[model samples]
Target chain A: MPGYPPAALLLEDSMKTALRKKLLRDMLFARRFEEQCYQDYQVRKIGGFLHLYPGQEACAHGVMAAARPGEDYVITGYRDHVHALVCGVPAKEVMAELYGKATGSSGGFGGSMHIFDASKHFMGGYALVGGPFPLAAGLAKALKMQGRDEIAICFLGDAANNQGTFHETLNMASVWELPVLFICENNLYGIGTSIERSTAELDQYKRVAAYRIPAAQADGQDIEVVHEAAQIAVNHVREKGTPYFLELKTYRFRGHSMSDGGAYRSKEEVEEWRKKDPLEILLARMIEDGEITREEYDAWDEEILSEIEDEIVPFAENSPDPDPADLTRYVLVEDDPYVHGGPSKGGA
Target chain B: MPVMNIIQAVNSALDGALAADEDVFVFGEDVGRFGGVFRATDGLQAKHGENRVFDTPLSEAGIIGTAIGMAIYGLKPVPEIQFSDFIYPAFDQIVNEMAKFRYRSGGQYPCGVTVRTPFGGGIRGGHYHSQSPEAYFAHTAGLKVVVPSDPYTAKGLLLTAIDDPDPVIFLEPKRIYRAARAEVPEEPYRLPFAAAVDREGEHVSIITYGAVLHEAREAADLLAENDISAEIIDVRSLVPLDEETILASVRKTGRVVIVHEAARTCGYGAELAALIAEKALMHLEAPILRVTGYDTPFPYTLEQQYLPDALKIFEACETTVDF
Candidate 1:
């Protein structure tokens, strides 16, 4: 690890104690929230493709930590609950959206896969395989065009790297020197197709390297590793005003979605990845290194559990469904552009 | 009013939008330096600068997907597809991703994307170049489909589409790019989405749109000499269909002939006839007849026979009137 930067380069050494405690709490919130949402799907409280982010807490915490709250933009494919949560969308609003409530982000129109918070710069979770690739490039182009220093972080899956958008957008970003960070949260498999069966190269970062965009890989389960790698990637995009590819090597604890049986991988493989559980790695290391007492960590876990079990769950369940008449809302914005001379009513 | 052709009108529309709004940008394959193969975007890059007017790789999905991102992030993107035939690659981005952004996000995110593509037959561009796919975009919900037939409507509608808050499929009839000159206003104006009655008569109402509007006009003139008064209604917007004008024309004329350059199978003409039957069937003096392109792929050698001409519309009008 000589040429590699230190794991905790982004975080201050003096604030290690405080950071350890906060990082654990952050991961805990995502875990408890996803745990409840999983149950919500079982009882029909949440529907559609309910992909949960139970074990991949570090990837969100570490990668999103590099994103400036209201400046840098973040976009990802589906399986994107924690990214929005980490980006500062209120848990209540995120849950309400999952519950299909008008009070939720996206007015409850976008469910799990399509969370959007424009103000927070968490653009949305694009549902298509590689659709957001070009969108991310466009956003970076917009940022540069408008003379903004902000960059765009596009999170694609391992399987998504094979998509044409990945190659096309990468080349465009490199050619134009647009500010973009293409992060691949390589969780080994895309639903059922593992990286081996899908990509010719196991390293997703190498595929996009053909465009002359520098590439890097990090331990996605380790917050410190992911954060350090993300900081470097984000810095490169900002300084060079071009794109850089980063592959955060990680694994998903849950199935691809609620309905997925996950018959593709063996139980042994899942167990092996579980041993490197992101939450446990930080919790165990922090306690052993005396960054925090065991009691303090347990208290934080209790706080997160109560927050979800008491507050977030009720907020979602009690949230009101959208009005029947308002069903046509958001199909277009306020001004009826077609109203100048077209038909009296638009076809929704 | 300034005399302009469809090509000039479209260019004027793009120039107007680019000059007025800093957020409006245009890009596509060979659109920037080459002025586009059809020159619909000629001189735009020079006037607006490379940032506003630029060329993108020949990837339709890349053009549309990036434009969608720009639209979501507070830019009005007018992405040209080069040709409608090259649009299938970006079909998912345009149809599903771009079209559903507003609805799926519950209105929090409405991407203003005006995808400009040239589509139609009669140019001998064959299967790859000559294709009319308005029905595909028209069938999709949450999309405004505009097919401008002449210069006046082309300039006015493209400008309106660029300003519209939602996604609009602005399909220009490539066959009529330089078809004829028409009186277009020097300043920016918006045309109504409602269909216009191009010619008035009592024998039959010829409901048509896009390139076929020309043939329908000629066919109406031929019908006039034969002592038959034919009315032609141009449906400018396929989605926000001017059902009122079409129905009223059908009721008054008491006979109908539908015309389009797309395949007869599942074409927009079928939708028009269905509407007339459902709404104005009682007023009909004869069953509605259709004059459309063949169901086969746009042919290379026999392109003339594959395309719908004025004679086809006149023959269909004859059958409807005789019935």
Candidate 2:
């Protein structure tokens, strides 16, 4: 912004302006959406476990910015409101999903963690830690078998790195030369434990080289940095039909969730990360580079805040709760045409 | 037509499916270069490219879970579990995901794939390898369970199982993999899931499947020598059981004995016994009997005692006639 950095010159002014506006809108929408979830959690409007994706908004928005909407598949862990939102899941529906309403993405069956919109190509928001790993690998295999150029994007936290499934999935993805982008959102701490204390190899993408897979590490806090790095990784995955790994180094601003007491990390560390907030950084750049006036950035923030106030929360509040009778509707099919359920008049 | 064993029939079925449909692919442990541990998928990788027939990581969950995803994307993936005993690791994938996918998705997606596992107690595989777990799957709603006793039915039924719209659990009796051989049609054929009446008689009815079918046959032979006529029925498919054929045989025979190598408490045999008792109760001359493996942990050393053999079937038949 100050001196037209050589890397920054690669993007034209109009392209940069449009990208900045979209990134701000999506990231701010995610932030405001999750912030409303925190409020809903306190009021008990949304029950069960709720994981927030506050500071890691840039990672989801940045990656989806590079990947296609309907063509690609997106899978992530429980902290997936932002991922679903970035993939074009209506903010109101995602909020209602957290509320466990009938209008939610999964018809209130999956609650917060198991949200899925097959039509939108958001494969799932699997609750089990690292449970989506093998599924992502399979999705990549399916895409490859169908001779499609689309890739799969799988998001995992730092804690998932310790799971054997993580290794198993990566190895299988690499061996099959599947088109998948494994995005490890290294937000310093997984749930509550810091990465250094839990994980042996802190640099996760470097671990992929042992499996002969291509990988890179980028700053997760910077939207443009993440977007650019992801573009390269996504392109490489699509062109080569091989797995690509990305370890985005970022930090979560809030506690793991509304329940966390913030006892796991220091206030000083949290403040330090908050200082480099992605939204603030983008706003500063937009102002300093003369890309937009301060009024525009203020207007964008107002729009996100007003949308969260007037759209997502109100829609969730007005949404109907799931009917008790329909609780067991999806559990099993009452009449499966494939297998005769009750009695068969025997004859071959 | 070609005469082959159970394993050879499986290989033929896989080869035929792969050649017929470009979407059909096989992957599992030792399935590619080694042609599978039991050679059930023999020579598939060589004939088809590695892309179609490949070996996967030694992970049951991975194999089953990935197959679910592949099936959702319109690919017909036939994953091998090496052995039925080893499929427990994938129990969640089978029970939770694959079994419930169609229903859970509100019919938006169906897990239309096949899982081929070798089952039954023979060849002295002991507890780990030699066990019949069909009852567990039979309890599942969305799954189709079929056990092929001989090669001819193995090929035809396996082809049908592969092409079935729903997920099918094709359990081949590993004990009879090479022991049982028959002439199978060279060209494709289909075997309906209903029961096949092997021998027709008027005195007693013997309903069985898999390894127990051989015992029933031997017992039927012995009953014939003793001047007692017995009808033999082989239930090719356990889930979509051939109740009509079984009831018809029992009505004619006026007596029934259900046999299976699985534990006695609650097996597919129990289901068959209840079905006969419910439908053809008026036709019964005596009470229905069941001769099954004892209800105990499949003992490693005492497998012979734990398993029901031809002698037990003969004893049960005699008791049924005496009653």
Candidate 3:
């Protein structure tokens, strides 16, 4: 069995200059998109819990870069807008979903926390902690049973590891030798509680050792580091037909949700982590390597901001609210015999 | 037609599903080589191979959560909980995830998982081993709750449940798994999610399902001796409850006695009573009476006293007829 890939192969000349620039562009776009969402929530245009993915852009971008989007299955926790966008779900649909519009990915039924786009194979963004663990394993089991090479990629937070499903699924995934990559975006704190306080074993990757799965940790702030580690982990799972765990050491720059004031953490701690911002680190690396001029980077940023403002925002704002008359739709299959005429005033 | 017990009929239904669709999979603890603790999946693994019918880790959440995932990927999975009492661990997954998959995803993902588990008390099993939890799932929308009273209903209803394009909680009456024997069709068949009018009468109506259906039959026979005609209706499905059938029976009989093995508090009988009171209040000559277990945990030593028996059903029917 292959252990964690050696660090000697890190940042080899394998990543082309063009790909690196594209990743940076994607990460910047995601950051701007989340900022736009935060603004929309403040204006009451986006309702329900809004979990912005600002500081953890590199995690989704890096892992998705290593896997075949729209083919391999992807599942994640509620902090999932960026993951959906990276998996090829249109930004307009994701925004519309947050706005609870019919044009949204889930037809407005599932708001921010439950984004789903089956066409993109982005299975879903589950709201319950540790709920996606076994679902991801099931997806992998499906692929293996069908003799398909596609693997299932699951993204969860450090706190979700405390859920019993985390242990049950890992053991099953290892015992069955399913093809799955379990990505732990360790943002240090699960909401207000710090990892050290909640978990006895602070190292999330070390927890996977009990299941006898190969595991590693990577710098989540740097896209290059995340991509390289993800590539090794993804390949190991697909080739060996086994599970692998990859923990990204990162931090969320914002509160857990829109309602949170984030008084739990010290201001200095927040500022200290923000100093290693993922976007700034990537931009600095590109500048040092002369990949693009600073002026060009500024112009690209402006163009993305304009697109979000002019096109994406308008699409979500103009999308229609779901019809109340069709409130009971999708409760069952479309042609279900009991769909239109069945027991009335029952539970759901 | 082949005469088989409820366990054999369940195994036969699973056999037909596995042979009919390559996507259908049967899995649970001790279901593969051991043929399930109740043997409801006996000889399935051998006939369908390990991949199609296999055992899983002893985790209800893992069993159900994985079934949802497979269902999302366009596969049919029939997962079993060893017992209904042990299903609480996966309650979140079933209620929050599996039941809401179709609704939450806007129909993009229809989780057509058929969760099979044996429930109700008859043997000396304690509270943990015996529990009728159908009311819990029936209370939740987007889930179909079905219970089988005999071999014929078991085979036909199991097949229909697997074919339905929604999640179903297929609760089997373990008490009558072997005792309830009848002639079941040899080939695949489907039974709609409606009540079956087991016997017809006019004086009083006895509505029941699962193992208690047999008790209701005994109660009906007892009523017949007294020249008091009684009707017996087996509620095959609970969620998409056939209210019309129940109401028509209520309208004809003018008296009702609902029976179930679950506790009386918030039991399925409550729903039936409320529905009758709401829709057929004018036709009712007497208040709807319920024959059910007490609002207490199932007692191991006094299980017979705890469960609703034929005598209980007979007394409740007599009271309704006299009123």
Most TM-score-accurate candidate: 3
Clashing pairs in 2: A345-B244, A346-B242, A346-B243, A346-B244, A346-B245
By TM-score, the better pick of 2 and 3 is 3
Q: Write the per-residue lDDT of candidate 3 for residues B1-323, one digit (tens) a residue.
A: 77999999999999999999999999976677667767788789889999999776545787899999999999999999878986887999999999999999998999999999999987545445678899999989889999989999999999999998899999999989999999998899999999989999999999999999999998899989999899999999998899999999999999988889888778899899999999999998887888887665554334566677888878877777776
B1-323, model 1: which lDDT tens digit per residue?
78999999999989998989999999986677667767788889889998999876545777899999999998999999877987887999988899899999999998899999999866544455678888999999989999998999999888889988899999999878897679999788998777899988888898888887888899989999888999989899997898999999988989888888787768887798789889988998877777776665554334566576888777878777776
By TM-score, rank the candidates, best first: 3, 1, 2
lDDT of 1 at A322: 64
Residue runs of model 3 more than 4 Å from their true location after superposition: A1-7, A339-348, B1-323
Clashes of each: 3, 5, 2
Return the DockQ of model 2: 0.02
After best superposition, candidate 1 residue B126: deviation in angstroms? 38
Candidate 2: regions farther than 4 A off: A1-15, A337-348, B1-323
Residue B149 in candidate 1, Cα distance off native in Å: 37
lDDT of 3 by residue, A1-348 (tens): 333445567655447889988998999999999999999989988865678898999999999899998888999988999999999999999999888788989877677877899999999997667789999999999999999999999999997886788999999999999999999999987665576655778778998998999999888888888888898899999899999999999899999888667766789999998998988888888888888888988999999999999999999999887775444356467666542321112222
**lDDT head-to-head 1 vs 2, winner:** 1
Off by over 4 Å in 1: A1-15, A337-348, B1-323
lDDT of 2 by residue, A53-85 (tens): 877888988888888965699999878888887
What is the alpha-carbon lDDT for the whole of candidate 2?
0.80
